[model samples]
Target chain A: MDRNLRAMASAAQERGLALRPHAKTHKCLEIARRQIELGAAGLTVATVSEAEVFADGGFDDLFIAYPIWPSPGRAERLRRLAGQVALRVGIDSVESAEALATAVGPLDVLVEVDSGHHRSGVRPADAAALIEAASKAGHSVRGIFTFPGHSYAPGAPEQAALDEARAMVDAGPHAEVRSGGSTPTARLAGTGPVNEIRPGVYVLNDAQQIELGTCDWADVALTVHATVVSRSGNRAIVDAGSKVLGADRLAWATGFGRLPEFPGARIVAQSEHHATIEFGDEAPPARGDILRVAPNHVCNTVNLADDLIVFSGGEPVDRWRVAARGANT
Target chain B: MDRNLRAMASAAQERGLALRPHAKTHKCLEIARRQIELGAAGLTVATVSEAEVFADGGFDDLFIAYPIWPSPGRAERLRRLAGQVALRVGIDSVESAEALATAVGPLDVLVEVDSGHHRSGVRPADAAALIEAASKAGHSVRGIFTFPGHSYAPGAPEQAALDEARAMVDAGPHAEVRSGGSTPTARLAGTGPVNEIRPGVYVLNDAQQIELGTCDWADVALTVHATVVSRSGNRAIVDAGSKVLGADRLAWATGFGRLPEFPGARIVAQSEHHATIEFGDEAPPARGDILRVAPNHVCNTVNLADDLIVFSGGEPVDRWRVAARGANT
Candidate 1:
């Protein structure tokens, strides 16, 4: 296991907060099993297909943290999942709550609360209405959950977590599992009503984490090992491209991806096969020099690989199959 | 097979042009079989993994049309592919030509001549040098190929095709297969020095094609059938997201994805399970209404799905497994 992940798990344990480590960032059963063994209460999944794979791999307690819509095929799978394990799903509307009642019977669902993501989820004030709807629909509403996605901004996680926790707590008697904290917000998510934290990218921090001053480069356990294929003066091209490190360049992101080993080196452009790098001061790496690239986002990066070769020191110890790698639907 | 695909293939046949369709778009053996039956000359692949999948499925004639850098692993795979089928690879640089000869042995390679994409491939003037390098390395130099990628831009395909044809013809003896056409440029590509045309997206015209005035929405064969999950007054959320339709949204692209069936509806944002939709004078679709979304880029969209539920007029015809769906690296 990566030392950084172990330390993060230790921190969560010390805080008496149950870690429901999100598996979307590293969609490997090995990592999930490790996290569970290290004292994660359950695993957090982004898709029903992911939950299905994890459950098949003996993970009984799982959370499909995303506010997923239940298609007829998907609803059947959810019902199957409910029968197999202690399953918890996310809901944000009365319509969805009604559909869940009709399709999957009585279910334990967390009302998705918006903490500033403005993407999905009901507003903090709207949580009571959803809870009422879930109750009226005869579903077991467990609690409320919100993502501190704005925590990516400077000095936002601590404040966002505080606000998120307050929202969950203020949502009355139904709100119980006050889920909050991303990787960036985990450390700042002080003990409060927040009982569980879903931090996916903490296992393998990215360029965003490094830029946010949340984690050091050494803390990033997983990286795309690429060989230098083109060299031109102080510039060179690495073999890893968008396919290896996903092309998710956020507004605040430094580049397409980051080369943590090579500090200040910028990946200016990415073709399908070549990732052009501009060295700050150090001489360009020779052709065939293996460089470790930390992707801008780990979730999309894991989606790109079929298998992960886990290494302790330089020796390859184990290979983890990305079983849920392409569960897009 | 979709009727539009058959129509497009027939249109090419009428113009006396051979369609060696690019299979990187769908990456399905079933789709390739349909294309071949519809009068396609052979198959074109973007990566070695794609070629391997197609070849293993009894595709005898394969063209790896990308300007691939022959790394040891890729070269070894290519050598195996050469032994299995009638293989023709693409080369843009003299170094790559030399490397291909050493690794893949003597090979029939297409000298990649630049059109307007400016991504991979050598300039037309540089084509002779690359071909000479291949000949010197004791490799069978086939011809030259160019992609009119910039043809996706407004009114560029016609001029781009002319430029590409001139470049190929300028190479003189080295230019045997002056390939110059994408879906957008296929109509402009005439029978001159250009012996073959590689147009992949024409098989499944996308939102990009429709916006580029290359094809009508009705001509688009492949559409992601998504159901509305969440609805507000102004914006609604659908099940199709980046994971399904892909996140390759160009700056000029009108929407994240297009709704061919629901005219004037556009996808504004895409999360993993939610696609935020913004309607333009179009009646808002009710929750559970299956919207047929035409992805902006069909190649990457197909790469996301495990299998394509091929539909012939609202009924499931066949389930085509995307053999090379997640074959990244």
Candidate 2:
């Protein structure tokens, strides 16, 4: 995990961009502190609850990367969190920006520009309106942030980065800190546009990362240690299931998950407690044999886990509690 | 949740079968106690951790529905759990049965039959072999059990129930307790062969249940209360996303989730903290509007949530902690 953190931090440094690795990927305070120690500018989170955790954990700067619907309770917590850290939140609409600006005191708001993943965020051209509204409503406009989520596909990183650059350039005049991210487009995203990147999955590269060619097998830092309980012909049933590996099936994902050890083997299906694997050329694993499975997505999988058995030098060395695992209000 | 519990219990009583609703759906000790109060025969869990949580919480007569891969840690826990209650576990393969028998000590085991899901379990015709193996391993053979998971899709419940009955009948001679389950096929499942059912989702029907015509809007016991943060013409963004609603998009699911208020509006996509909704009506939700979102899969959604705001008579009467939320090992 430290190797992944250093590699991503170094990559951002080489490209002259500040690394603000998304904390939603790991949700562990120890990992977040390690990332900051390795030169992360600030931590990026998805919720106010996550911000609260990292804030309580003593991390100074935090950014809620999603356009939050600040309720009365959330706004109150946001104000409390902001007082403790250099807190920034994403705002995509004029209504939300104005409401947040009035409900919460003194926040650094970023215009969320939709870089093509139509999931959230405002249009790049229309970001100026939200930015202006937020600025007028007593919030500091911090340029823009765009999530190139479309880069998750097999061969779409370059195009997603181009989209991110275009969106960042469009919001460049509004303010200062232009942020763009997505692990797949993290390297390409620093293309003369964004000053900060918030790629989360790069810290614990998964099967999706391997499939996208973003990381090699050795680059994967997190893996679910599973024991084979049953074997029938070429089929082996492992203890790890969707509850452990997570139920994230990308369009191009080969199976439920990937086995780095046996590349030919596919995690064919998963129950809540059992993952059925179709063994490749290698002989079927004996009962009680442990194997590592790289899940389809790291963030959701981390949320499901209680603590991570940190392995070093091929031995279990340390354990880190997933402190912010359930910090999803 | 009370309504769902009553309706399911009543339905099972009418069929003269015991309703052992799977606790994996809610994973709340409070809810499990309520189910027991409502005359539920027992509780069904998916993992050893869940079993441990419930056993500690004082719920007896527990069944680990999945064919668990009993590792050393899990075996030790299972043995401890069994000593406290009338415990039973599913066994599909001979190897797992023998291992579990030797590892966990004397326990009641059910030969799991593949009804129609094909995800886990031995074939109906071959269930006898597994039953025989468990009996030989000093484990008491407790009939058969089948998960009609295939019933989750539209127009599949009736056939899945038929398969369930056939499988139960095939394993009749080897055991005493015949169990069949699934919310979609619960009523259809008590077709004479099964004496008990384990319909978990029926206690908190989700979008998939609504789509499958297994339940209606009024039957939905749980909902994600989300506030609209942004609006773009007919499109509205809600605060609840995969983090709260869960990322469970079935092949037959029409959207990421369903809005009970506007049935026609589709939850087009979801990120970690934002759900993008494209309204089917002319009137769209404004910022600060809270809407109830019925998740795609209630079990996973429940697993993500920390606590549930139990509403009665359109008022928040109780706040139940999801004590067993992350009890997935």
Deviation in Å, model 2, residue A45 alpha carbon: 1.5
lDDT string, candidate 1, B1-329, tens digits: 36756875876787777788888787888888989888888888877888899999999999888656677788788889999999998877777778778777898888887676665667777778878888999888878888867676777778888877787687644466666678877777777767788888887778888888888877888888888776766677887776677666666778787887666777877665678888876557777678888888887778777888877767897888988876655
For each candidate, the alpha-carbon lDDT, in order, equals 0.79, 0.85
Write the residue-wise lDDT of candidate 2 on B1-329 in tens digits. 67788888888999899899899989898889989999999999988889888998999899998778788788899888888999999888888888887888868888888877776788888987777778888998877888888787789989988878887887664357889888888888654798899988888888999999988999988889888877777898888877778778878899989989899999887877788899976678788999999988888888887888888899899888888887887
Q: Which lDDT tens digits does candidate 2 get at residues A148-260?
A: 99998888999999988988888664358889888999888654788899999999999999999999999999989898866777888888876677777876889888988
lDDT of 1: 0.79
Q: Deviation in angstroms for B138 in model 2?
A: 1.5
i-RMS, every candidate? 2.7, 1.9
User: What DockQ does candidate 2 score?
Assistant: 0.60
Each prediction's DockQ against the real complex: 0.34, 0.60
lDDT of 1 by residue, A1-329 (tens): 36767887888888988799998888898888889888999999888899999999899999988776788899999999999999999988888899889988889999888777666788887889888899999888888888878777666667777776676677643457878778887877767777789999999888878888888888878889987755555777776776677666665767778887787899877654568788977798865578899887777778878888888877898898988887755
Window of ten residues with lowest summed lDDT in model 2 chain A: A167-176
Q: Provide TM-scores for the models.
A: 0.92, 0.96
Number of the predicted model whose DockQ against the real structure is largest:
2
